[model samples]
Target: MKTDPTRYLARLRVTPGYEKAVPAPPSVGVLIVGYRACFAAAPAAGTPIASFEATTPVQIDAGAATAMALISVERATQRLRIRTEGGTEISWEENYFSAFGDSGTQWHLLPVDPSSHGGFVIARGAWAAGGYQAVLTRSTLIQAPFAPAVVSVHNVDPHTGERRW
Candidate 1:
């Protein structure tokens, strides 16, 4: 049943793209409305280059709902993270906040070499590990087509911590 008007949330749109490797740090423009995070990728030296965006528009604000926000991309060694207004980064993977309940954030750091067939390191953390934790799962060389050479950071116990996914 519809409890209250402020108890609902909006939908999210995630769009991804591929382009030339950026050699330097990019001048990125990010927008975070409420708990939704919008990603805008640009050139290293600062240009409106091609980009991808994932909106973390779902968040539980002082209620009994589950809000989720996350970002994922293959072959990503480094990424630009979104943070609070005063530069307080949400975490490595994403930022999550809630007044309703504590689903915290699900953090996953997967080191994957899509072009190579080798090993992987997976580290993850979440409720099972005391609410929010980030750990890696290691694996040996994998030379399979469908098998991900991906080591995933499995779960997160809280809304903190960052990693090089």
Candidate 2:
């Protein structure tokens, strides 16, 4: 079975009093805080899974002025990928680690199901950047051994925190 790709809008909020300055002035910095997970079609519920308010934000060399979260979900597997300009690509997988707690990076595993898995990839990062972008790709099963994949891209405006699909 083949399924058409779907797009969903998502947002990232700056943690109150959690912003930090980058070593190189005027450039952008990022501190990622993984909060919770939920379905892309639904809203995020419950408290955050992790917190980075107490941790000091790390300075990274980024000039793009935007952070990105690349989420991919395929049969029995899910991954969250993060990247910024001049920064190394960071990734978290559902089955790989229990809970990541290092250098302000954190993530939660998605709930498992027989047919498909559902969850949202929530994270917070402060940067000189304007907004955050999230791209989600999922393979959904409509029949046994046959699944169709859909992709969703979401952007949030830093000024208004408005989500645009």
Candidate 3:
């Protein structure tokens, strides 16, 4: 029961290096294409799991080696997976978007750490209490093992919000 990766959300501007910056934010929405994976014996086993893919190619420097993109899976942990040039996959232990709409940032400051994972956050019109919403506070460039890329942003749907994948 895999879903097709066919939607275009937004054009994300990935900064350079590991340095952090809260530049002018972009209008936001989920970017990756979402899919639900079902096991052959799923009903007898457990619930089906969801997965997502990067539909848009990442924009990196001309001489950059590694490339990174933000993605998410329905009902799965908000962990990040980085693929190496040799095809090796490294998974990050943070669900960065887990606290987007937390009590602290209802209509105030919403801070997002690039290393965490969870529900995806995007810029919204109103400061709503629920849903995947947040302002781009800081984006850090993850180094080595991946690409020579400078920075990247994670945009995905909230865990408990309506499924847009």
Candidate 4:
């Protein structure tokens, strides 16, 4: 079975409180979205067996910055170079959101010291064959202290054009 296309939007919000602490850092930020595919019949739920991922860069502005990506998947075997501890081969037929992030730089996985920027994945779902459009939004704080970012996943019906979060 083939998976439907998914669109992801990453937004970086620079709050007023953050600005009061420090002016916008003169550097661009990076946003990453990752997908992990697991065997639909696997005994362990949400265990990854295969995967695909991508990233984009966003400039830190006074208010906000945004980035977007569109992706689709097809049913195919993904071979693993290294076998599992049990030496078992694996095949994945379903995909789900595995990770999301907003970082100070592309080289860093998370916001470094003095960056005050971060993000997280709030929701995830397995991709269904011939499914509706999936919309994923990640909102992150650029310089806000103790403020948590949000990541929301929604599915939009193709026929009725309705969104279900």
Note each model's CA RMSD in angstroms: 22.1, 19.8, 19.6, 18.1
Candidate 3, position 39, lDDT: 21
Candidate 4 residue-wise lDDT at 74: 31
CA displacement after TM-score superposition, residue 61 of candidate 4 (Å): 20
lDDT of 3 by residue, 31-106 (tens): 3322222221111112222223432222222232112123222222234455665455544333344465222111
Error of 3 at 110 (Å): 16
Specify the poorest-scoring 10-residue window by lDDT in model 2.
107-116
What are the lDDT figures for the candidates, one per model? Answer: 0.22, 0.27, 0.26, 0.26
Question: What local lDDT does model 1 show for residue 127?
Answer: 20
TM-score of each: 0.17, 0.21, 0.17, 0.20
- In model 1, which range of ten residues has the least summed lDDT? 42-51
Q: Write the per-residue lDDT of candidate 4 for residues 1-165, one digit (tens) a residue.
A: 332112223433333354454334223222223332222221122222111122312222223222212221233334444565657565542222223322121110111111113312212233221221122233222221222233222223346554322
lDDT per residue for candidate 1 within 74-145, as digits (tens), equals 221224465656553332322232343333222222221111222111222332121222211111111112
- Alpha-carbon deviation at 15 in model 4, angstroms: 3.8
lDDT of candidate 4 vs native?
0.26
Q: Single out the weakest 10-residue window by summed lDDT for candidate 3.
A: 104-113
Kindly report the root-mean-square deviation of model 3 from the true structure over all alpha carbons.
19.6
